[model samples]
Target: MEQSDRAYQRALREQLARNELTFAHAPIGQAIVELDGTWRQVNGALLQMLEYDEVELLAMTFQDITHPEDLDLDLGLLQQTLAGEITSYQMEKRYFTRTGRTVWALLSVALVRGLDDEPLYFISQILDITSHKKQVQALQDFTAMLAHDLRTPASVIAGFAQLLSTGPYDDEVTSIARRIERASTTIVDLLENALTTESIDSGRLTARPTALDVRDAVGTAVQAALSAAEMNEQELEVDTSGLVPAVAWVDPVHLEQVMTNLIGNARKYGGPHVRVTTQVHDRRVEILVEDDGPGVPPRFVPQLFERYSRAQEARTGSQRGSGLGLYIVRDLLTANNGTIDYEKAALGGAGFRVSLPAA
Candidate 1:
């Protein structure tokens, strides 16, 4: 009895869908597609979607207008549905409209059977998603501009301040110079984070892994961040004690950037004196950074590496950050087969351990 009821309900739906006999209209594209990919009937919405006149479209098969890259995927899915392996399938695909412009749409197709359980035709529905795609692209372009316009000047300002700090100067003058460099560094970091985040979101990140001395990379990054530490009235200590230099498989530039970000973030939100230690174990190299300041609140630790996350103390600090630093660092590390972890430091501060595969 249930089987008969289901069959009857299916028949009713097919009847409503076929009401081309009654002049019903749909706001989204709908069509009856023949097994050979030709259109048996097309609604007004489908005609507008393809930018085609009814007379022209009826003469062309669906494959005649699909984007070349998407054609195989669409056909494969259709074959799966027709073979009884699936009931229906929906996918995002592209089409070339009559005017040669590309259209993106959510294309859904279902196999329809006659009362005798034999194939009749397929029902296809298309929802235009081109506008959404355009919105996303526009956002990415604006983000790119934000990164470029802000980072360039920040770099210049940091460079000049670094040069200025090298002079013999009074305590006050040197202090001001240090602060300026740190502030400029912050600007560059935030802007670079924007670009890194965009690359991560778009899956376009590039990594060139090579064997390099990680100890030297850490030392270089620490030297790069010395101005910022000084600006915070903090001392940075590097402990390479008993540490034989190890070659690690990583993108050197990215690893250095991650170290710079880590050191900067530590100096920003943690205590004054910071310690950086390096070690190697079990085919991995570890760089440990710890600060002698207040550790991250236990509650905030779980959210540390999340995008746009900032510690509560950082939110109220004199210098503000864009809250994207650690997130970008994590992404950069993962791209190069490295990893970062945060733990409470035995030095009564926050500790971060970065591990990379030894080359």
Candidate 2:
């Protein structure tokens, strides 16, 4: 051969070697299959992914190794690509290995054509996504267990605290007992709210709805909140104007908890004069709790209902209640098919509105 021809041949050999290296070391599993789905060519990753040798894989069709449940959809997409209806397709599919274990893969398939534009083979690129799927499933199970465990302890703490407060005790030690009770109550609230938020996020909460008298529920909540309001030297007002004793189909305990939280929050955060009003509409009933204290900080309103969130800037002093009140309120309302929102109060303070479906 001439000197120039020798150089050209050397360069061609180097180019071919580079191409071979690229195919062997590619990160994704790559394979070329004939129209009948027989493996014509496969890279190193492909062979390792299927746990098969080159000769073994070449003797089998793609359908032979695909998961039985996923084969139909995979074949449908392949047929579409072959029929010229689509150029390529991608899907999360599964394949079975020789050891009978399933492997999850994200498969991308493209049609390869010859110089004459006639389809020659199908090219597939696959990525193992089994690890990612396992992580997601584990996270879901953890959330469910966390929610279940937290609620029982919370109920016990709150129940015992209530028992201690109402149980017989000396007048001198009553204050200390009350403080202990308060601290325990706060912890209980935090746990309950956190668990409820997790339950809502995981779609595990269920509501047993029934007809309830809105006025009676609100009255009971107001009575419960009055003690807190009086402790803060705050005035509690109830405005049931145009609101009759209407019945609503809701979870009574959940709705009562919602009312209690909203009222208690208003008393804790509002100015000296706190007003709770109720209005009945055609389709829904709206309860508004307004306070005269400095309103919630503009920035904190958006995340007020988030778990463990506190409106520190909006709080009056170091005497802050559990930051979980609004979060619990939101969760309870959601469970009862209701909604809550915070806005500037018409009475120059913070306003919280709870809307419940009418019976």
Candidate 3:
């Protein structure tokens, strides 16, 4: 061969090697198809994605392995690309693997042309996006659940609130009025917590942490829990013996909500009297809420911070709760660098403790 031809051949060989490596080791699946849809070349990733060996894939056309539901759309886009009306198209499509399992892919297709501007082949890049699709579906399901679960309690509160406002009632009637108000307040708190959690998950909630007097904050939360305690015929007591000047570096509003939710939970599931006590340690401020009711089931302790996770036995018996409260409480505490835990109280019931960094 002439010197010029040898140099040309060497360059061509290097180019061929580069192309082979790019196709075989590309992060995304790649393929080349002729105008008739026959796959002339496929990358290792594409072959692996389709669960097919190179020999098996080489014999099949792109359309043959496409999911039945996606074939029409895929072909339509490919036709558009070939017609020169569009240079490229991207879509979330599905294809069938050798084992018949459907694989989701984000596919981008483009037409490759020769120097004469004639269609040479089609090039495609595919990314597996099944995980993203599943996350979107999960978010949709969560939104639906929130709407349905929240509406029921809201309707109860609205119906009873109007009834209570309509006319004068006897002592018995007044007592029921109080119960309706308490239930309404509880539902409102739940809605707020749900919205707050959504904001936090979406990275929209910003905590305004400040120096807050732990004693005053606990007093405010205790006041909010009083009505709930009264409705349940439970007594709520707050003792700040060692917390007279107790202060913590935290978001006051968030901390108050956490305390109210904890105390309310104790009142709802704990026996008759629930006591909230605050104390200050060397580096942390501790708030302990204890109830006298049946303690939490041992198995449920680990999942206390998970959303919608309630003890089946507790829900079945006398302690039915929406189960979002504790989850929200934990999230709020975590955001503020605080910690909470569930334990069997020395008072013979469930104990929820919140520890915050001292101011």
| Global lDDT of each candidate | 0.84, 0.78, 0.80
Q: What's model 3's TM-score? A: 0.57
Worst 10 residues of 2 by lDDT: 227-236
**TM-score for each prediction?**
0.74, 0.60, 0.57
Cα lDDT tens digits, model 3, 1-359, are 69999999999999999988988899889998888888888988888889999998889898898888889998998888888999999998988999998888999988999998899998989998878878976895696479558867786784676477445977777677766775676566666677776766665666789988877777777776675565656666544353457688899889888887887777667756666777888889888888777888888888888888888876786654677888888888888889999888877789998899998
Instruction: Judging by TM-score, tell me the better candidate of 2 and 3.
Output: 2
Kindly list the per-residue Cα lDDT of model 2 for residues 1-359, writing each as its tens digit.
Answer: 69999999999999999987887799989888898899888998888878999999999999999998899999999999988999999998999877778889999999997898788999888898989978876886786577577667766765665566666877646555566656655665555566666666667777888878787777877786775554334576655453466677788777777877776776666656667777778778787888787888898878888766787764557555657667778877877888998889998988998888988
- As for lDDT, the candidate ahead, 1 or 3, is 1
**Model 2 residue pairs with clashes:** 271-293
Checking candidate 1 for backbone clashes, the offending pairs are 271-293
For model 3, the stretches where C-alpha displacement exceeds 4 angstroms are 1-168, 171-179, 234-242, 318-320
Off by over 4 Å in 1: 1-26, 30-43, 53-92, 106-125, 165-179, 235-238, 273-283, 346-348
Point to the candidate with the largest TM-score: 1
Worst 10 residues of 3 by lDDT: 235-244
Give the winner by lDDT: 2 or 3. Answer: 3
